[model samples]
Target: MQFTTRPTLSGTFGMVSSTHWLASQSAMAVLEDGGNAYDAAVAGAFVLHVVEPHLNGPAGEVPILLAPADGEVRVLCGQGVAPAGATVAHYKGLGLDLVPGTGPLAAAVPGAFDAWLLLLRDHGTKSLADVLKYAIGYAEHGHAPVERVGETVETVRELFETEWTSSAEIYLPDGHPPRPGELLRNPALAATWQRLLAETAGAGDREAEIDAAREVWRSGFIAEALVRQAGRPTLDTSGERHTGTLTAADLAGWSAHYEAPATYDWNGWTLCKAGPWSQGPVLLQQLALLPPELPAQGSADYVHLLVEGCKLAMADREAWYGDADGADRVPLDDLLSPEYNAQRRRLVGDKASFELRPGAPGGRTPRLSAHALVAAVEGEGLDALG
Candidate 1:
């Protein structure tokens, strides 16, 4: 459950794994040279693409939560949007559901690279070279493979295998993945990194850097591979996504919004997290239902409540949650408040609470900020009788 990273390189840092470690190192190097946290963060993320390919790549999305030293937290949404005319109806019309690799469909505008460079110019004390030094070194000389990374490579080898004849020269040779400790390296990636590392902006237009990074991404053989899956000949986009409008145009025309996340107070703790645009508020809503003193950490009652709460949360999320930007105004705040949670918890039977829920209650509102601890009034905890 402890999914976090802390690097010796600088200020209170965290990453998911070792590639994230390299990214952190690159950023920390910037921070050590007097750069701010944002500078370090950007440097780290940009490098993760090459180091963590199956997950992150230039075509991949980037979303972040940042709290500056003296400012309120802000979100930068780098998740790419489908093209100007992309409709879910169209997807259904085509019946194309198979997802390709770190590819065109998953592509959003390559904003992180540009955003990172911009962050550096505004907050970093070091030069761009200083920020990218570690990334360049790793791309060329290679670094230690992170745990499960090689396993992931092996798992997905068949999906990306091409019949282009020279394609084996590009990826796996003889249809097998590179083994662990075999030095995962990419010279194409190195050349791309060198371009960004060496470029000098005329007026510090960081968007240009994002453009360059995305351009670098377009050169890769995988970038344009959607053609292989195209079922229709004239529609331009086959079943696979082509390197289409997820471009510098999209990046240049884009603007990210900063929104406040939701929080809940439960069991004498204030739980802070994202909104119902994801499953974040769902967890909060479930917790808000139980009495303030539901066991301490992991008693029997605690385990039962946690499992039951998770089930309730999942049901609600499925029924209500969707994109905050595009869908009906979701009742995320009201959903997470104590009133609705309390009402929903009623669905759980006092004796067992292990069975059926027809549906959630309606028109509830948060009423109590502080409540008396109502843990166990009569019997021993965790008994079916109680």
Candidate 2:
């Protein structure tokens, strides 16, 4: 008997999918209440912050792709940029080669909160209070902590206790991380939302109110708190403490913007994704490198082709992808050209190739360090597993 891992899911009505059930349910509830996709997404996203803090939080990024019935598809860039003080010289001075995986030094200008607001303001019909209520309820009352949440708390327990005392106050209540499936509450998070709402009390209409809230977040109390914390040195994965480079000026300077999605047409289907700034373009690049006809689903040949294609695409992503600003802008137009992919597709041979090969689009040289090449090979291997 063959048992498939992925079951066929069919639904008569609309469906909302997320990592957590509470988030999916919250989005569904919004839709049931006559809200649009944008409104439902905002509601669900906020719920995720409360229920799955281990996976996502207010400080994270969420690049949203909107396909409106009446309008063309657009990409909302929610990913935050590196702080102004994050420079090669600064890191070199810190005796660090790579960005620390954990700590204030690793922090970016938080984009999630503002991105959600931007979506709400431009596309959604719901008010800030309407979408935020569910998250507030979950945070103030309680939500069942997923197993990974407890495990994450355990992983960072020592750090929280020793340096990040504020985190310990919430994740380690009474000197212990919450057990899995135990009801956990974060009243402080709820209070913060409440305060944000309070600040927008007198703002005129819906759009005006959302704008006011954005101001409060970017230039007001939220910005102040973030800067204060970032200024303090915190323990990191480097076995040392380091202060963040983020500033209120950086927060104030940044805002979420909408851009046309990078797209690829394959086998009568067009796939749109975020631009070169993100890894989204890698999928399109991979498809361009693959054959017109794919092997049977779940087959070894199909998996092999896909994995090989991903390696080539990811290498290019590491080599060519960068911020579309100044001298570092990626030559996306040249990379996505059919001529380029045709040349790259030849790299896929009969056997597995462990070499990390990045194509030279527009005759531009790929400047990857020896260490980075090794890391890319290892990273792509892990990505192939799941």
Q: Estimate candidate 1's alpha-carbon lDDT, on a 0 to 1 scale.
A: 0.54
- The per-prediction CA RMSD against the true structure, in angstroms, equals 9.2, 3.7
- The C-alpha lDDT values of all candidates are 0.54, 0.87
Off by over 4 Å in 2: 1-13, 324-328, 369-386
How far off is residue 60 in model 1, in Å?
A: 2.1
**lDDT tens digits, residue span 1-386, model 1:** 34458745543543332346777667667667676676677667767876776577654555556667877665555544555434556544656443233434544444455445545554555556656666677778876666566667566555445322333343464566555566766666676567654544442455455444444334333233322322212222343434333433454454434467667776577675555555666667777767667776677778877778776676566556665464346767666666777777766654454332323335522121111112212222223112
Model 1: lDDT of residue 235: 23
TM-score of each: 0.69, 0.93
lDDT of 2 by residue, 1-386 (tens): 46999988888767899889999999999999988889999999999999999889888998889999999999998988989999989998999988899888899889899999999999999999999999999999999888888888898788889998987888999888877667899999999999999989879999999999999888999899999999898889999999999999999999998989989888899899988888999999888888778898888899988999898898888778876342147887777888998888888887887767788898888766657667756755323212
Using TM-score, give the best candidate's number: 2
Q: How does model 1 score by TM-score?
A: 0.69
